[model samples]
Target: MARKMLIDGEVAAVADGGHYDYDLFVIGAGSGGVRGSRTAASFGAKVAICELPFHPISSEWLGGHGGTCVIRGCVPKKILVYGASFRGEFEDSKNFGWEINGDINFNWKTLLENKTKEIVRLNGVYQRILTSAGVTMIEGAGSLVDAHTVEVSQPDGSKQRYTAKHILIATGSRAQRVNIPGKDLAITSDEALSLEELPKRAVILGGGYIAVEFASIWRGMGAEVDLFYRRDLPLRFVINFRESLLLLIL
Candidate 1:
């Protein structure tokens, strides 16, 4: 027998009066998944969200609560950029008759360590937010078992299953390496953020924001950067007016 279920104001036929472990089960605890699950829980829906274990460098089996933006993407990149921008700041300070006493040195280890600490702290904060919101936080990789069921594989070779009235697959995107020879030799933005030592020289291949941003970052940090792109100009899809600014910055 089938009964109509009202979900998000939509009526759909489901198994009549079927029992569910949660009202909503989200398969990824990335930004999208976390936001959706938290919102659903706020609305009195019993929500459970599953994510892979915490890791700055994401893999198929390892992602954290706050997703790419917080864990490895924007936050870390911005922190590095802020650190690199000090060089220009120091130079500009010279124009204001501010004389520096000693040789200015950038400590890569200290910055890297602090950045990692901030990331870990934010991970804990996200967990606390979920706990406060009444969203069950499950640490594992989740897979769809059926339309209304999810199976999670834990870190210790254990699996758990849960049924839900509605399932949300908010698994985020992953960076794809180009299908070229020696692709494995190239590091994605993920690895670029967590480099043990600052690069002395870097060659970036691509015209997207990531490539341009890295080029600027490395160059600002005193690395020789060469950017290669297939298009006549990098960021061809960006607004025409911003092209000149990007050119000057890069």
Candidate 2:
């Protein structure tokens, strides 16, 4: 007589109904998680998303709502790149019949401060977007308790558990330093983005997009950069623009 349904490959009775706390529980508040939660919530499903508190530098338990791309990765990197590119622009302006006065100085501190303010503003924007979509936002690190349950570890050392019909994990990724001598002394991209002072000279490792981007960013800002990679050439896999990219790096 009671309704029957399949959950986790087992037949379960749905006669009681309204058993779970939410229709959906998202484990991360990154771009992907936020989008997914919003879309689901728009469809009238009760949704909840949990993420760590806001911080520029990410850890296992300190990522912001906008996630890596907005908080520390792409958005911040592009801002620095634009700030650095001004030096070249100023020089090129001379060719365009523009007379420049005294010495043009780049202040790393000012750029860093403004970049952080923009990131913080974007983080809040993402939170508001989620709220507007009728999604519940929880501040904490989320872990899976079971197939349909999530346990969030709050910042104040409190744990809250919730049940949902479905769970999604979009925790994103973090930067990892290579294992070598003085590895501890080396900083990852996370710390690099929020440095107190800009390095007069920088030594970068690897040949990936991030490595090359940083090298260019620092070089544009008037830093002495030495890039080292164990490859025949940087961006070897980028067959299309490899030649042009190589020239840019050099």
Candidate 3:
């Protein structure tokens, strides 16, 4: 059944809301889902968003609010980068004729604890935002049961079904660990951010942004880093050619 939606100088077929519990049902409470639900709710649409329960460590059943960017991706990575850069600063100060006498060391536990606290705080903030926007936030993993119905599996093994006029999927991404021998011994960037001890030797095996960033981070913090990529040039496609050339020259 084709339905009509009013758009910019156009009418398009939209979801038919003959019998829906909500006008909008979002699958994930990541940045996109939260924003979309909030916007729809502000426009007087009945919106409900579902997500996994909050935890410092993420898994299939324990994804927190704020999604990848807020929890495991950008926020935590940048915090680690900032903490790691201090070693570079201390080293560079010697060139500037500053006499520093103390033995500097990095505390992985301290940084991890602080980062966890900050992410927890941000999660609460996102929850409050959803509440203020009048969006019903459900805690669970949502899947499409039908075109207009979502089935959520909660952490406690309970399930709930919601029918909506339109459903949104914004469950965000996860780190893909490469398959190899002894793969369990290796950690992805997500785990790297929360390591209990800084590694003395590290080998990163990718040319992507995350790989290179982790390489730089560990190297800056006094780790022996060997980055391996299939291509002769690292970050070849991602970095601007001229900028990469300049960096290599330098």
RMSD (Å) per prediction: 3.7, 4.2, 4.3
User: How far is 62's C-alpha from truth in model 2 (Å)?
Assistant: 0.7
Q: What are the Cα lDDT values of the candidates?
A: 0.86, 0.87, 0.82
RMSD of 3: 4.3
Candidate 2 per-residue lDDT, tens place, 49-71, comes to: 99999999998779999999999
Ranking by TM-score: 2, 1, 3
Mark the regions of model 2 whose C-alpha exceeds 4 Å error after superposition.
1-18, 247-250
Worst 10 residues of 3 by lDDT: 1-10
TM per candidate: 0.90, 0.91, 0.87
Q: Which prediction has more favorable lDDT, 2 or 3?
A: 2
Model 3 TM-score? 0.87
> Which pairs, if any, clash in model 1?
none
Q: Which should have the higher lDDT, number 1 or number 3?
A: 1
lDDT of 3 by residue, 19-124 (tens): 5677789988889989888887776777889999987667889888899889988998888889888887888999999998977767778988999889999999
On residues 76-161, what C-alpha lDDT tens digit does candidate 1 reach at each position? 99998899899899999999999999999988889999999999999999999899999998889999999888999976889999
Ranking by lDDT: 2, 1, 3
Cα TM-score of candidate 1: 0.90
Worst 10 residues of 1 by lDDT: 1-10
